[model samples]
Target: MSKPITKTNNWVLGLTGGIGCGKTAVSNMLEELDVTVVDADIIARQVVAPNSDGLNAIIEYFGQNILLPDGTLNRAELRSKIFTNNENKEWLNALLHPLIRLKILTDLNNATSAYVVLVAPLLFENNLDKYCNRTLLIDVPIATQIERTAKRDNTSIEQVKSIIAAQMPRNEKQQKADDILNNDRNLSLVHTELVVLHKNYLQYALQNTTNAP
Candidate 1:
């Protein structure tokens, strides 16, 4: 294991959950409260943009067939290739994880909010939680995850299940989390809970600032 990447002057709250578990909703609520959110998904796309080094390297290894007619990545084709082959998945992870992590760190460090939310689906899997002052998991039942993801993405249930299997298990994530927010209820209820969490995070951020030498 590597040491946690230290932030320059921000309190980071690592937020994650399995697909369709309302991680976005929670992040959005926090953002409405003026919290800075450093989203790994957005950074992932930025790192592999049309003319990026990440894209060029991917094309070099997987060939131009991995790209679309518009010179952007053919994500569906690449996803199919990686999902069926563990070696390809590992290779892709090796190439992209570091780049994503660096970009996430940069964004988090640059954020000017009282606290920052680092939102990554693979937060614990990639050891990103280690960078946080605390970790939060947006939890839901597996059935809910499969149903919601299938409906939202228009993907088959089996495909959603496969993606869920690839993630850290729900119980394992619960064990790792410093806080867990059950997202099985309505959005209004979730937001109500989040307001309290947001206040707690603000206080933690203040304490971190006060204690910094």
Candidate 2:
């Protein structure tokens, strides 16, 4: 479903998919085509940088174990902790999500490309489609997701399945997408579909960009 954005210049494309669905590859391709991408994963890291308020909040709650020798957040340790302990995960989300949302809005407002792609793994789950003009879902089979993620992350298929099960299911995502990128095949096919979406986004942006009153 499409949401009404009051600003025309900030036309946002909320791009999302399941784990190991090649969202990184698709975002890179869109970037190569000159689309500005405000990625949630990248923002998530930035919010907890060494001296930030978000980091301080995290340390106060999770303690020093969440940090590395170099003062960066210990992402692996946090991932393990949160995945294993539901309470820890919920507490962390309570602390970080508001900060992340504020940063995302600032980034989107500052974007200079024809249109922006806000790449997020949990776009739908977080109800972030509210910030977007359209939602783009990249579709891939679960077996493929398990295979690719396990291979790329050097983890087991079971671990990948656990991660996938924790997310919004593939069918639910497909149903919510305003536009779908069928990415079950090779890069060439993905690129072909992306090019078409690129054109569509450009036209949408141009049509929606309003002159100042």
Candidate 3:
């Protein structure tokens, strides 16, 4: 089990899964029920948006070739760079993780719903689950992941596999999760499961509120 780096008053439900594991679908259902979801992927992009401090720092490290003609981060180029070099990946993570974490925490703090859902693909890999009251893993088979991601992203199987390789494995995520939802079925079935989880989260939030000092 990972230890939390910071304690928060909000009842945070850490939601995660492997690439293409239907995390967005689950988070959307929760949103329909009025749950506030803080998405780390969005924050990750925001931190590196054009002209931002994060982008400036990245450019300082990687030079002009890291940007597109539009002056935006060349994500594919950066991905290829880091994928081939462990040291570069580590350096990049060291630079960006703190910025991303800070933004995630800020958004979570501002959320007004009964509970906040912190949706992060790298939740366990980055140890972000330590901030949650409980963690939920959306699990699907590796075949499903590759198929879904390649279809959705219009990417090659090898590219999808590489992305999966970069993520924490399904078994490892399962071992760390407080709850797991199998997402191999259709959206309707997945939503049904989520409804139950939503109710449980609401009840847990109420309990936490009642128990607060």
Candidate 4:
């Protein structure tokens, strides 16, 4: 693993939320504002890309059935297996978390942003908040989560509900947050909040660091 960003300088903001809470939308807005955003989901996929060490390790343990005909991960099949079985989930995490963490650290260390956002759906669950100077939670009602997720994923409401149930709950995440972005309404409303947040984060990062990340 690459060495962590120097301890004397801290500019990382860990951004997270439950399913369908619009974390991606917020991240996109931040990116458009020229803030660097390192998405863990993207890194997670990279670590397990075909022929990578992560993928080879996974196949060694879980068999070739997890791969699609094109030699890529059949994510839906793997998701069903892991979530249905606790041991499977634990095993997958054990193999992949270190790989993903190394990549994230390296990216953060190299980033030139005034501050960087480390976006992870499992930011809290995976204890990634430790890497951040602060945590930002995108908040929404459970009903909103279920409704939006069902629509976006083309899955049943029950399936969305089950996924939500498996993740850290909304209330718990909200309580742990250092900042919140309420995403209950339209994008314009969320964008308004984000404008304030972008300024706040920029100022906060400037206050915290002597120089850029």
Q: What TM-score does prediction 3 earn?
A: 0.90
For every model shown, what is its TM-score relative to the native structure?
Answer: 0.92, 0.90, 0.90, 0.88
lDDT of 2 by residue, 1-213 (tens): 865333435889999999999999999999999999999999998999999999998888889999999999998988988988999999998889988888888889899998999999999999888889899998889999999999999999888989999999899999999998978898998998899999999988877786424
Ranking by lDDT: 1, 3, 2, 4
2 against 4, candidate with superior lDDT: 2
Ranking by TM-score: 1, 3, 2, 4
Give the RMSD in angstroms, all C-alphas superposed, for model 2: 4.2
Which residue pairs of candidate 3 clash? Answer: none
Top candidate by TM-score: 1
Clashes of each: 0, 0, 0, 0
Best by lDDT: 1
Residue 23, model 1: Cα distance from true site in angstroms: 0.8
lDDT of 2 at 3: 52
With a 3 Å backbone cut-off (N, CA, C), the pairs that clash in candidate 1 are none
- Candidate 3 has an lDDT of 0.92
lDDT accuracy of residue 207 in candidate 3: 100
